[model samples]
Target chain A: MGTVEFAGVSKTFGGKTVVQALAEVDLRIGEGEFVALLGPSGCGKSTLLNILAGFEQLTSGSVRFDSRAISNPGPDRGVVFQEASLLPWLTVWDNVVFGPKVQGVARSIYEPKAEAILKIVGLEGFKKALPVQLSGGMRQRVGIARVLVMEPRALLMDEPFGALDAQTRLSMQQLLLDVWQKLKTTVLFVTHDIDEAILLADRVCVMSARPGRISREIPITLPRPRSIDDLTNPAFIQFKAAIMTEMRGAHGAH
Target chain B: MPLAGQLSSSLLAFILPVSLIAFWQLSGTNGVIFGGALPTPDRVWTAWVNWAFGTPTFGLNPYVGTWLQNVIFSAERVAKGFLVAIATGVPLGIAIGWSRLFAKLVDPTIQWLRPVPITAWLPISIAIFGIRDFGAIFLITLGAFYPIVINATQGARAVDKNWIRAAQMMGASQAATLWRVVLPAAMPSIFTGLRIGLGIGWTAVIVAEMVAVKSGLGYVLWDAYYVGRMDIVLADMVSIGLLGYLSDRLIVALSGWLLTWHRLQSFNQ
Candidate 1:
């Protein structure tokens, strides 16, 4: 149900001088497929995700989600920001239930769903705590939980764990893997980290900066039920080596 | 937050005022000062006692036993005006901040009117509503509206873009987003405007009463001065200050309770 397509999409920022953020970027993800846009900073990967999330206007071309042209953000496609961006005034429970509550879902229905999602995200104990009181990783858990509670068809995550410490990031990665393995929601993840892209996605679309475009698309053939332990697997290392080489070549072209 | 600490902090605040009162008293002779033009602290206290508790003797002394009535008059006017300001200003300010079209339509008019001080509006208010409670209220509302609306606009404008996006992504309609997300997020700034607005409300009420209304602390202040009752005038001045201080504390207390999240943020910093 979560098919997405971007056809000849382009975006430009206007000022005294115009800067093209994306130029004729084309991509597609099948239902329940996990795809990551991997690139260095300023590669417009986040811009692409923002456009698909209905938060940005493409200068040209069209984006379709579930065969419908995107007009505005809605519950069908949930976005997890890098900074978590949970409303600071709201507690964990309120943040998780915000989507359903605003969408006018009955309390009888969304309340249990919210409770279950909180438990899944391991934040039932912290449901009453405000966002400011939480650690960065814990806040990101709430971010994921809030989106998941909406039961979205697709998840667009923009470097959801990029701000965490290494150890915290690994745990969060595993948490996401565990959650995604069960839900199998279509995900369009944006990140600059090569290892993260390889570890999580079914296909990695490598992007290059300066009129950002997808330079290469590599399919990860690793078996499912993945874990952090897969990071050391020889097959994962081989994929990483090839991607690193491709990334270097992409960088050299610019 | 300890009891002892809180008590000591409050007591510390009183020391300077107490010493100032003592100095004022000592510098005076026979409860009078400044060649008998000004009354001493003791005289002002005695006047307050009479004004508050003395029996009214059929217009013999208008100031006697009338303190509470005048206080209520002024406070009620301020309250009504401030409420009107909030009712009109908050929504208008939010609209101005949230919608560019609305801002374009209304914001320039408000800005043009803002620099015209409340004192300047008094003649127009008197001309329009002349010598009535509404006249006083109009002045107070005008006085309070600018700060309230400007601050609320700022609060609404400064709302984090991501918060709005998050709400949008959650399937919130534009109205729901403004109410649920923009309103709550703008609260801290709204409180700031309320405080400033209330202060101006007090000033406006005083100005309105002294000129247009026949009763209230401001009327009593000007009347007591005219009748050569320096003690009543001093007491009235002190009464106005006390009322203003109490009302400001009321707003601060309300903001403290409503903005506990904001308080926690500052504490963390």
Candidate 2:
């Protein structure tokens, strides 16, 4: 049910000068699989994710989720924004429960689920705190918790930990790895960090900028239940080296 | 300590007005000023006390014990008009901000008409409602509507794009998004509009009462002036100012309570 397919997808943002953001991008994500679209800035990775999330329209080609043509954003696919973007006015509890409340899920049904999700994200004590009152990492935890409460079939995360400090980023990565290990939701993670892409994703699709297209797809055979410690593993290092060379070659060709 | 600091700050703010009143009182000769064209602050105070507390003698003094009544009249008019402005302006503004088609259809008309002052509407209001409370109410509504509507539109338009996208992604219907996400996000802006709109409401009530109505503080202001009761005129002017200030305080307090999150956000920044 979490399957996603992008068939020859092309997107051009039209203005006085038309900018082609993506061209002939073909990709597929299987149910419960983790994929990362790894690229440099301006590689249209975000645009691609936005298209798949139904936040933007592709000019040509098609995107499908669960074998149906993607149209508008829905609870079936949850998106985690880079900024966390928790409703500034809502407390962590309100933000987490926002999805179920809006979808008319009975309070008796969603209340326990929300509490459990918040605990999973390590934000049980922060339920009463407003987003602004929390630190950046705490806010992101609320962000992840809010999405997790929805129990979406697929998770679309766009540079979710890009704004965190080095230490905070590592902790957040570990938290995510722990959570994703249990849930195993189909994930389409976009990131510029090579190690992050390798550590989190099963398959890393390296993308090139300027009419963004996948330059290479490297499969990561890292052991399951991976932790931040695996980042220094020799096997992980080897994969990173190969992907780095692929990125350099792709940039040179451009 | 915080309470003491607040008290001192408030007292500091009153220094200018207090000193101004003192100077005016000291400069007056026999409770008159500007060669008897204006009354001194003391004379205005005396007149105000009489106007507020004097027994009704059924005499020629129209303002005898009528201060509270006139104050109520003006306050009531402002309240009614301001409410109508909020009722219509908020929804209309939200629609204008949310939908491109709605904005294109209605925005130009509002922009064209907004610059036409509330005073300009006085003749039309009187012609229609005829020297009654409705005329003043109409003007007040017109005056308040522009700021409220404009601010609300700006507030709705300024809502973060990701907020809407997030709502949609979370299975919120379009209507639900507008109600829950867009409305709340636009709240700070809506409060801004309400404050500006309310200030205009006071101005409108005075202008309308001076021209189109026979009761209220504004009517008394003009009536006292014509009879050369400059003491009552000054007293009436003070009454209006006090009311305006109080009403504005009410709105500020309301916004403070409703927008606690927004307040925390600014403090964090």
**Which candidate comes out best when scored by DockQ?**
2
RMSD (Cα, Å) of model 1: 1.5
- Looking at the true structure's interface, with contacts defined as alpha carbon pairs within 8 Å between chains A and B, what fraction does model 1 recover? 0.75
In order, the TM-score of chain B in each prediction is 0.96, 0.96
Instruction: Give per-residue lDDT, candidate 2, residue B100.
Output: 96
Q: What lDDT tens digits, residue by residue, belong to model 2 across residues B49-167? A: 99999887877889789999999999999999999999999999999999999999999999999989999998899999999999999999999999888988998999999999999
- Estimate TM-scores for all models: 0.97, 0.98
The TM-score of candidate 2 is: 0.98
The fraction of reference interface contacts (C-alpha pairs within 8 A across chains A and B) present in each candidate is 0.75, 0.95
- Per residue, candidate 1 scores C-alpha lDDT tens digits across B1-269 of 99999999999999999998887887776445566667889989999999999998897689889999999999999999999999999999999999999999999999998888889988888899989999999988988899899999999999999999999999999999999889999999999999999999999998899999999999999888898999998999889999999999999999998888889989988
